[model samples]
Target: MEISGYIALAVMGITLGLVGAGGSILTIPILVYLLQVPITLATSYSLVVVGSTAFIGLLRYRDHILFRKAILFLIPSALGVFAARRFIVPTLSNILGHLLLGQVLVILLIIFMGIAGYFMIKRPILDIQNHSHKKQNIKKSKVVLIGLALGIIMGLLGAGGGFLIIPTLVLLMHFAMREAVATSLFIIAINSFIGFVTNQSQFIASDWGNLKKYLTPSLLGMLIGLYIVKFINGEILKKSFGYFIWVVGIAILTKEFIL
Candidate 1:
């Protein structure tokens, strides 16, 4: 590939390392704007790449991840992903296909990223100090609800769902931020895989050359990111990452709106 392509791949890796979900948000833009892949194809490709990377990361952190809780969350999310992929995304994409659909997808991507960015910056005050007893009482229900909600978003938008999952775990479920991040990666991996499987037919029809080009570099970057997670102060970095997301989202939105 060219220098620019390598640069973009490196950027993607660094972004994922610094902030878990940014890779999904940036994947479509890189494929479409930089590599000239069609938007629909780009979205599918992004899901495959992000899902694969998240799966690898989750595997590395499996020992630390809370499996019982993760499974509880995954069940509802799996159901949600099935429902959305079977009923929602195809319907919406069909309706919007003619009206600059690529632009519309880009706009939606930006909106989601912007919301994620804002949440990152705000860093909701989590009260985990004395909620141990309360957590046991309501944790299952909260995990299921969050999983369903996150799954719907993932199915609809091709997102990895880390943005929603991490916050939900940390703020409402009262998990430590680090554990939440680890858990979110697992959830994102599962949901993204399910969502991609739901759209397998369409993907098979598309030209997937760019995705091939992306695999090695993206995986290398993800490995680097996983390694970095061990040493970083995630909370502070997450806040700064939010600012970065805001800038990228606005820039993408502006480009779509104006040109």
Candidate 2:
């Protein structure tokens, strides 16, 4: 089981390397179930793993990162993620019964998985000629709002909000797909890092070595995945992965609410 867990963590990194966003979706589940971590700690642990891998990925695209946009997007998300991890999660855990909140969060994660899967399957229509218009049409307010929301979700779940962030950058900020992806990776890395570092548990000195144990192999997998992407078709892998996410989401729902 432990070896299998390591393999799963690597697979999570490969997915991230292949697709960029879905790995966070798998992080918490991997930590909670495969690594046998508690839900509360698992979420925090996930941030470390996801953030580290993302930062590594970001290093490759360092030249492509939009500093202006990344910083603007980070302001709200950073604060929100910190606040959620510091104050909100513990409160929620206290207020809701263990079965209730875990069940509810699992349900929400499933819904997000389905939405992510759908978008992965349905590639958006792109107009190469309208690139300039797409770049100029973004609403700063929408960007800020979404940034705040994404931060909170990331903090609470310890999952990168890449699925949502990528679309927001493309649709709202008028960024090209490549730019949007690079920028989103930057945003996610900063957001997760801030949330992980400022966590309340740090004051109490929680066991972060556990996170490193899971993170090390995932990073190795990410590097291998990066190499594999040289030959693989990302679009095809993305869609197939989406279907896999859909199935996993349904399976989680079924396990929680059904049999």
TM-score of each: 0.83, 0.91
lDDT for 207 (candidate 2): 69
lDDT tens digits, residues 89-189, model 2? Answer: 77887999676777767767787788878877776524532553554656687788888988988898888888888877767766777777778788888
What is the RMSD, in Å, between candidate 1 and the native fold over all Cα? 3.2
Best TM-score goes to which candidate? 2
Off by over 4 Å in 1: 1-6, 98-100, 124-143, 229-236
> In model 1, what lDDT does residue 53 have?
75
- How many residue pairs clash in each candidate at the backbone level? 0, 1
Residue 243 of candidate 1: its Cα lDDT?
87
